[model samples]
Target: MYDPKIFKTYDIRGIYPDQLDEDVAYKVGRAVVEFLKADTLILGRDMRLSGEKLSGALAQGIVDGGADVIDIGMVSTPLVYFAIADYGHEGGIMVSASHNPPKYNGFKICRERAIPISGETGLLEIKHLVEKGKFEKKPSGQLIRTDVLDDYVNKILSLIDKKRWKDAKRLKIVADFGNGMGAKTLSNIFNTLGVKMLAIYSEPDGSFPNHEPNPLKEENLKTLKKLVLKEKADFGVALDGDADRVGFVDEKGETVTGDIITALLSKEILKDNPGAKIIYDLRSSWATAEEIQKAGGIPIEYKVGHALIKEKMRKEGAVFAGELSMHFYFRDFYGVENSDLAILKIAELVLAEKKPLSELGRPIKRYFHAEEINFEIEDKEGKIKEIEEKYGALQNAKVSHLDGLKVEFSDWWFSLRASNTEPLLRLTLEAKTKELMEEKKKEMISLIQG
Candidate 1:
């Protein structure tokens, strides 16, 4: 019997072959086909050792449910989304673990517009179908292989003006693929752009021999930072396991957060399309919204989750949206998020003007943010209720429960929410000064721990 708990708030992920196996994947394929009534679907996978087997099994189920499959084998999450949108397919699925440890793997599914499938949207139905185990078997459908690497590369290149790439002087960049699927697609794209690239861990190794693929962890980005400074490269780029999320290091070896990158890109994008709508997750710094407003664009704040953001983007016709976790979305690019495409735009902005990244980031104001703190506590619901009653009466703060408990004050704000996957409370706070942020963080921690 399949468990519905594995169907999470964001995407389907768990310990592979145990919590999620080929049987579960097969059922999920059938559910998706039935739900979307998709006649044609696109499929792709990451570099995880189990991805190949899972993709095959899932494809079997998708075909068995009477849908034709376009297998764009061994690609990233964004690339899978790209193939779905570029080829005008009805839907797509990516077999990936996406920054999780080796024991984990799962799928990211999307309908047209590359819209994500989440629990509140359609993941619950998919889970219910799997648990019911009552799928009507149909005749085996056909599977076709279409290597869309060239088409994908061309589409990305088309986003940037050809004159920019042709007239660019010799530039050096250090790209750290981290043994993920980024190497599979980025190599050809970079070569076509004539970039002098120093690539590391470009091989597709699911074991992740060099370092874990998550660049958000400070330890994972050490090698990339060193390479950037050692080579005096123009910049450094890092991609998560599935390559949908990106991390960047400046020429000076300083790590740049996604908020800062989004701020930079917002200026460029708004220059072309004034008064366009831009979206950012609540976890991001206020500077993102301020920058968007300063650029004459409307800024919409949404809860943290790609599915929610994409839905909001489609409704508002947002030109661009970014998350603090390095996911960047675009309305023009079939409304699907793509880190690879974001990288290309950043490269163009850098080369268009001969300014270093640190200089480019100078305009945006910075703040001290406490790392997201998680606590395993009993009475998840009761504790939140108590905290809300205690702090809900504060005169200087405005509290809201969008995703979790968010309290906004004049110069600072903090949010405490329960983790969907665990018995834990996640706290995120930001303030004008490090001392203030530290004091606020300690006070909140005491209240929750008490």
Candidate 2:
């Protein structure tokens, strides 16, 4: 039996063999098939050493549950989503840890366009079934191997016009794959685009020799930044373990946050699709909304998380959506979130402007944003309640509880929310000036700690 503790707020993740094993994986597969009543399912796995074995066992379980399994071996998370929708399968699962350490592994599931399973959605039910060991066994169905990589690459390339890429002069770019699945798929796309690419750690090694695949961490991005400047490349791109999240570095060796990229892309999209609806997560910079409005697109802010963003996109009929954590979703792409597509879009926009990305970002409004701060506390709910009671009555400030306690003032706002994954409270603050942001952040921290 697996430890119940490993079933997380987002996906099922844990150390291999000890916390998660083939047995647990099979149980999860059985539960997923039963839960969705899936007659046919698409499955993909990352390059982790354990992935192949786990996927095989999971497929076995699915087949045993009388569900046919279509295995697309060794692919990224987004590619799995694509295979599911493109092939019109009933549901799909990607066996990947997604930016976690090499020792960790997990699954990302989807049914149609909806991420049907989350911590509160169907994960708990799956967990309960796994623990109870009451899975119903049935006759074996079928398993088939289908190589969809070429089709996936073709589909992604079709999203961008080839003439646009060919018209632009070839630009030198560096891509640090962090030894994840990105290395496996990026080559085909970049070669087709005719870009001069310098690939680093382009092998699929789950141990992540050069650095962890998480580009959000400055330490993880240090090498990519230095390399970009050293090679004088136009830009550098970084991807997470499953290649679902992307990070960028400009020619000047400066790391750009996902929010800035979102603004840049939203402006480009609005130029053609005027008044299109764009969605950004609440944690994004205030400039994101202002830029969307400036570009003549309606800006809609929603709670954090891919599932939340996708749902809001459907509800608002939003054409595009971006998250501060680097997950970008496109409605035209069957609403499947793809960081590779976002990176390519950014490249295309920069080429179209004939300007450096840094220069293009200057006219946009700038706001001082504090990195998300996490506070470890015994009572997360109590601390949030205290923060609400203290800040709820402040004059000239509006209080909201959409995702957490968000207090909005004329020039500044702060969001204090309990993290779903850990026993901690996360705080994000932004303002017109650095001084004001710091001042408010200090006050909010004091109140929250007390």
Candidate 3:
């Protein structure tokens, strides 16, 4: 049975065998080929236990739908995007439920040049096709087993010249791969550079025996933080299930939010591409824009979601973009999330400054953030309108409905958005002072909870 719930705003994800078995994968594959009208497509998967069988079924359907499949097996989601954009495949699919538990699995679809096919783009039609359970049969296509790992790694290394070393050896890092796809490229890059790194759970295991592959949760990063302090490493990084997202831990065991990374990278990226536009999600701290402006780069506040950010970057010709969820997009990588490249960029910044990661990130922490708060409300938009009717009337408030409701003042700001993937309302507030942030956050909560 095709569980319509699996078709999400971003991708198709659900519990394996139950909600998203081989049958669903097969049907989705057929729908993708039929919809894209593609002659050839690239395919890749993560280290999920169910990936092997599911990929086999998906390839069968793609072949049945008259599109040849270039199966780049057991690679990161970034690698799949690279194969599609850099190699010029018509479209592609990555079979991996990013950051989800072991029992869950899914697929991320993309078009030519790695453009994502979100619910707004074409996922809903694909869902309907799967539900209809019908496809016009054509000549069965061939499946070619290919490995693009070497090329992907070379692309990552090209950004950071290995010949120069360039003080890179002076930096030491503690990385937690969480037994996901990150271990593949990180291992190759560090080995080629001969950088000292304390790698934890580097092995590619579908079970994710060490911890859940989500770095956003503070608990998942506890071991990484501990190792960084114990090893006296300059910094630490944790890669999520598919290695497309990442989280950073500084030298002092402080968690560096994604926005702060954007601010830090702004300084480094702007040095080369002066006046380049950099996009950050609206949830980011004000210091993100401040740092970008200071570095002579244009800072653009955009709504969240990887697909939307990628499109916004392409349209604005942004050199870099970062989301609060730790997804970093780079123009060099065709405006897609590349956690490996993000890591290398951070390393380069630290090496160039000859300072600790904390020192490099300190200036970016200039404002007070209430952190993201989530409320489970049945009527999310109704509550948002209620809050808007109240705050929008303020004489000094500037309201924007870009991704959600954002009311801003000279001293404070807040963004309330309904999550695209889950049934929840997310609130992000910041202010010039910590006290002000707390006060505003509390006030916002009352409105949302009511």
RMSD of each: 1.8, 1.5, 1.2
Model 3 Cα displacement at 30 (Å)?
A: 1.0
| CA lDDT of each prediction against the hidden true structure | 0.85, 0.85, 0.91
Worst 10 residues of 2 by lDDT: 161-170
Q: What tens-digit string does per-residue lDDT give for candidate 1 at 1-450? A: 255667878778888777888998898889889888899889999989988888998899899999998898998887888888777889989998799888788889898857788888888888888788788878777899988888888888778777767644467888998899898677788888888889999998899998999978889989989999999998999999999889988999988888888888888888888999999888778788999999899999888778888888999999999988888988878777787778877888888877888788766647887877889988877878888888788888788888888888888888888886667888888998889999999998999999
Best candidate according to TM-score: 3
Number of clashing residue pairs, candidate 2 = 0
Per-residue alpha-carbon lDDT of candidate 3 for residues 1-450, written as tens digits (9 for 90 to 100): 456799899999999888989999999999999999999999999999999999999999999999999999999999999999989899999999988889999999999999999989999999999999889979999999999988988898888645446666777899999999998889888888877888999998989898999988999999999999999999999999899999999999999999999888778889889999999999999899999999999999999899899889999999999988999999998889899989988988887777899988887788898879999999988999999999899999999999989999999999999999999999999999989988888888887886
TM-score per candidate, in order? 0.95, 0.96, 0.98
TM-score of candidate 2 against the unseen true structure: 0.96
Give per-residue lDDT, candidate 1, residue 198: 91
Q: Ten-residue segment with the worst summed lDDT in candidate 3? A: 160-169
Q: Kindly report which residue pairs in candidate 1 clash with one another.
A: none
Provide the lDDT at 359 for model 2: 78
**lDDT score, candidate 2:** 0.85
Question: Predictions ranked by lDDT, top down?
Answer: 3, 1, 2
Q: Rank the candidates by TM-score, best first.
A: 3, 2, 1
Residue 400 Cα positional deviation in candidate 1, in Å, after optimal superposition? 2.3
Alpha carbon lDDT at 391, candidate 1: 77
Model 1 residue runs over 4 Å out of place are 421-423
